[model samples]
Target: MNEPGGSGGAEGVRLQKVLAGAGLGSRRACEELIAQGRVQVDGEVVREQGMRVDPTTVVLHVDGMRVQLDPDLVTIALHKPKGVVSSMHDEKGRPDLSGLVADRRVFHVGRLDADSEGLLLLTNDGELAHRLAHPSYEVTKTYVVTVEGRVKPGVGQALKRGIELDDGPVRVDAYTVLETSPRRSLVQVDLHEGRNRIVRRMFDAVGHPVTRLVRTRIGPVRLGQLKPGQTRVVAGNELGALMAAVDL
Candidate 1:
């Protein structure tokens, strides 16, 4: 990453990356903006996608409006309650994350289903969010799952081995029996896959439907004692560990 523009003589970062990190959209979209001559650097119309600029010192404008680099990145850990939609808005008028956080600009890093509840990271730092959501980073997410019935002996091992889902093959990084009863079993599972409704579907595929699910951890960040419908800023070593997880 290029150092923030200063007299230290650091080279400027790629224009598209700077624009994308500023929440302009994807790098591709930012490239399009540059190609269309909508972006200007230091009063010069920059059409070249490879052009780099110092975000801290260089003046950037898109569509004639000044583009300000976000000086302080805000990341929040939210314990999303059940029945709340993961999106900013729901067509059905269902409750969403927007109600919990006053700022509509910050977006959820990854999604939890309406029926699922757990630690959901919301942030204005699009680049970090992109890295976390991307499967290549292999950020492990740990979950405590409650299934409808006692999992059979081989089931846990099977999940650890691998399972063929509709999208592709997936396997848990770790799996352990937390508690088991005749009617229900609580199991802790860790996986890097971020497919939609994966935890519930994984158990459902194994003939044991999920009764309840809660994500306990994402990378090194834990949900801890955060209550449902509550939000808190991620800070200190916890935030540092998360950024390090994605090589940010």
Candidate 2:
């Protein structure tokens, strides 16, 4: 059975997560609402911590106010440009992504380094963000890399084998050659680990240092047709496709 605004699922989800997914507020903001004795489930105020609710059955109200659940979740795919950080806002007032998102509350699914450009996911669903960013999920990402030198034989094998980094071992799930030249080669590197600068380091270790890298895909969502600095909302089965790819 499906609740009026919640998905039909048997799994138990945190009240704060549901509220945040409902776009009432961020997860932390929902917690504050709960702590203040303002949230109600089935007509009873819930001040208890870590309250779990079935999204398919619970009738939730926040701040003694009834919140009509959002019918569709918001998911945006952004083609981030180099030099712009993935953060919502920068203290230095650099061109952050917040200005590009029309909604006030949407947040990036994960962090992308300022120098790297390509697909970036933005969503209002915190639980989805948690699933996508969690290391345990091992979300696969494909990057189109331009390296400074000709890729040696077994370089791709070296990436798959693993490279030692400051954090720990970083490895690619799969990779293949795209194009090659004397000074540069473009290879597609697929990685399960989402460590910072892992792809660059992996190539550097194998003697083919990456000069420019752009993430072309995250699971099934591609940075397709989206130019740099452009944004568009995802709809229909694209949401299911993405979540399924990340095993959410």
**Overall lDDT per candidate, in order of appearance:** 0.85, 0.78
Q: For candidate 2, give the lDDT of residue 233.
A: 75
lDDT per residue (tens digit) for residues 8-86 in model 1:
3336788899988876789999999999999777767888776667677776667755555656778899999999999
**Models, CA RMSD each:** 11.4, 11.3
Best by the TM-score measure: 1
* lDDT of each residue in 188-246, candidate 2, tens digit only: 98887777788887787788888888998887788899999898876534665676555
Scored by lDDT, model 2 comes in at 0.78
Q: Which residues of candidate 2, in runs, are more than 4 Å off?
A: 1-69, 246-248
Q: In model 1, where do residues sit more than 4 Å from their true spots?
A: 1-71
- Residue 17 accuracy (lDDT) in model 2: 87
lDDT of 1: 0.85
Candidate 2, residue 129: Cα displacement in angstroms equals 0.5
